[model samples]
Target: MRLFDYELSGNCYKVRFLLHALALPYERRAMNFHPGREHKAAWFIEHHHPRGQLPVLEDDGVSIPDAQAILVHLASRYDPAGQWYPDDPAIRARIAPWLAVADDLTGSAGAARLHDAFGYPLDIAACRRAARAVLRRLDDHLAEGASGGARWLAGTPVPTIADIACFPYVALAPEGGIALDAFPALRQWVGRFRRQPGFIGMAGIMAPQIGP
Candidate 1:
């Protein structure tokens, strides 16, 4: 198995975190997106994904793109007992909405911070506002016990890909100036994630609150 990923990307970190948690071993191929390494390369497009996105997973001859899709695939293949993803239809339904929120909050807010604060610097105030809104939503959700008293997002006894998917960006949000102190529940959740075995920090990133 091989994982093609960008070291600094939260999306890529999602896959890496899950794989490490599962004790799955694979060759890591780091891609350089800054110099258009992923975009300008024909081999990458043809063999991996034409979308030129980082965090492309190759298991044997099969290739999977999109962080959520990769999570599903990893859980299904590595954990068929549905520990990471429940088999019950109702549980699955409940789990699905959190994934959407994770994608929106973590994906959107993370990108906003990366582009505005680190990469290009466009409208820092707007980006910070958007990131704060997402954090507040997560704070409220966790306070409501959306995880059913479990420490993770999917209500599982252990952390699932759902938790893994959102951990990196949320943890590193402060580097983009999105404060975590306002979200106590979210902060506790991140603490639980860090204590888990085989956890790996996202490369070139810092959790201003958690301190990596």
Candidate 2:
């Protein structure tokens, strides 16, 4: 397997995190996503992702694009125990909406991050507002679930793709100038996620230090 990766991209980080969690070995084809704009180059666009997106996965002669779609594919294919993405219908039903929420986060918080970090032209204020709204919804959902002893986005005993889908940008919201301080439940959820076994972090999101 080969991953078309961008070192600082949260979307790319999601795929890398799952690969590490599954202990799946794959070659990292680090792309020049920043000043170089290699993802927008003709070869990449013609072959990997027509949308010129990073985090495209190539395995067994098949190419897969879109971070959320990649997460589902990796979980379904590599996770033998069915943990990251369970086979249960009810659980999957619960998981689906959060996947969409992840996309919402990308548009809002993600755009804000690109603007602040990479100097992309965008309405920073509007982006932050959208991010806050999504964060509030997520915090409320997590808070409600915590009231019933559920910690994961899908209310599963273990972290599912739902958690993986939503975790990164939420954890990195501060980098986009959207603070998590007001959302205590969301903050707690992020902390819990960071501590999960096999967890890895990318730029702006640190992997927790183990042991004393």
Candidate 3:
């Protein structure tokens, strides 16, 4: 297996995070996304991904682009019990919408991180505001669920792709100037995620497990 990766990209980090959880071995094909813009190269464009995205997965001669799609593919293929993309139709339904929301988090928090940390040009204020909005919604949703004994986003006893999909950007939102102070549930969520076995971290994130 091979992963076309950029170390600083949260999208790329999601793939790496899950791969480590799954204990999958793969080679890292580093991409110079910053000053180099190697992802935009013609060779990568024509062969790897048309959009020049990072964290493209190459396995069994198939190249999969986009982080969310990669997660589904990996879970479906390797997860023997099928818990990540679970068998229940309702859980699957809940998981899909969260993946979409994960994209919004990417548009906001992920973009903000690029702007602040990597000198990419973007509206930092707008990004932070949008991220706060998402965080507010998620915080409320999780809090409401907590009343009914929900432990994960999909209301499952175990964490699902829904949780993993939304985690990295929210965990790293501070790097984008989005603070976690107002979202206590989200802070707890991040801490719980970090406590999960096989959790991994990237730049701007370390193991964030909280005290019990």
Candidate 4:
């Protein structure tokens, strides 16, 4: 297995986090996504992702692009316990929308991070506005579920791909100049996610501290 990754990309981090959680060993093909834009190079675009996206996964002669798709593929194929993408129909139905919301997060929060951290040209104000809109909805959902003692995004006992899918950008929202302070439930969710066993961190998001 191999991952074409950019160290700073939240999308790429999602894949890395899950890979660690599953204890899967894979070669890392680190790319220059920022200044060099190696992902946009002709060979990469022709073979891996036409859109020149990072976090492309290669396993057993198959190439998978898009972080969400890669997550689904990894969990479905590799997870023998059926934890990440559970088999229950109702659970899968619940998980689907949150996966879509993850893409929206990539567009808003992730784009904002690129604008600020990597100097990508984007409308910062517009990105933050859209990010807050999504965060508000997410906070409301989590807050409502908290009343019933549900924590994970899909209201599952254990974290699923839904939680992983939406986690990175939300955790890194502040880097995009979108503060998480106003959303208490969302903040708590981020904290809980960070504390999960096998959780890994990227550039902006830190791994949990071991001791005082």
Candidate 5:
């Protein structure tokens, strides 16, 4: 398998974290997005994805584009320990909503901030408001539940893809000027995730510390 990714992208970091956690060895082909390298050529679009996005995963000639889809695929295929994803349908059903939340809050909002910080000139106020709203929802959810009440989002005894799905952006939000100090449980959760074996920090991103 060959994974084409950009190092600083949170979406790409999701796949990297999962793969590292599972100890899966695959070739990583880093791509440069700054100069529009991903959009310049037809090769990236025609063979990988028509959308010309980074973080494309190739396995047995099949290409997976979206980060979430790539994560699910990795968990299903390479996780021999069954730690990242559960086979139980009920568990999956419960975990699905949180994953969706991660996508919206972490993925969308995080990307918006990143674009703005890079001088892309997006609507900063709108993105900041949206990100704050999302974080409040997560903070409220964690505060309502007991600390370590559920081992993970799916009520499992260990971390799963859901945790991996959300960690990067939350940890790096300060780079985009989003503060997380008010979210105590979320902070604890991030610490716990960092202690997990095989965990890797999202490298090459500009993240500054925010006061708790």
Candidate 6:
């Protein structure tokens, strides 16, 4: 398996986190998405057409783009226990909506991060507003989940792709000038995610603890 990766991308980091959590060994083809803009190269566009995005996963002869889609693929393929992408309809009901929220994070918090960090052209104020709204909603949901004895977004016993999907950009929200100070439940959820086994951290994300 091969993953076309960019170090600073939250979308890519989600895939990387899952690969490690699943203990799946794969090769990484690092793309310079920042100052280099290698993802726009003719070769990459030719082969990995349709969507020239970071965190492209290749397994056998199949190519999967979109970070959320890759998370579903990796979980369905490598997770023998069927925990990450559960087989239950009730669980799926909870999971799918949260995954969409992850995309919302990309547009809001994510766009702001890109504009600030990578110089992507966007309305910074609008992005920050979107981010704050999303965070407020997420924080409320997480708090409700806690009351219902669910720590993860999917209300599962353990972390699922839903949690993985939503985490990266949320954790990196400060980089986008979106403060998390008011979202205590969300903050706790982030800390819990960091402590999950097989966790991997990227730039702006704290490294997992190595001690017992």
Q: Over the stretch 9-50, how does candidate 6's per-residue lDDT look in tens digits?
A: 999999999999888999999998878889888888777746
lDDT per residue, candidate 2, 1-212, as tens digits? 99999989989999999999999899999999989999999999999999999889999989999999999999998898999999999999999999999999999999999999999999999999999999999999999999999999999999999998999999889999998989999999999999987678887898888887
Give the least accurate 10-residue stretch of model 2, judged by summed lDDT: 196-205
lDDT of 4: 0.93
Clashing residue pairs in candidate 3 (N, C-alpha, C atoms within 3 angstroms)? none
Which stretch of 10 consecutive residues in model 4 shows the poorest summed lDDT? 196-205
Please give the CA lDDT of all the candidate structures: 0.76, 0.94, 0.90, 0.93, 0.76, 0.90
Pairs that collide, model 1: none
Off by over 4 Å in 5: 106-108, 204-212
Q: Estimate each model's TM-score.
A: 0.85, 0.98, 0.95, 0.98, 0.89, 0.95
Better of 1 and 6 by TM-score: 6
Q: Write the per-residue lDDT of candidate 5 for residues 114-164, one digit (tens) a residue.
A: 766576667767777787787777777766654657646566778788877
Error of 5 at 128 (Å): 1.1
Cα displacement (Å) at residue 144, model 5: 2.2
Q: What overall lDDT, based on C-alpha atoms, would model 1 receive against the true structure? A: 0.76
* Superposed model 6: Cα runs more than 4 Å off: 208-212
Candidate 4 lDDT by residue in tens digits, 134-155: 9999999999999999999999
Between candidates 2 and 3, the one scoring higher on lDDT is 2
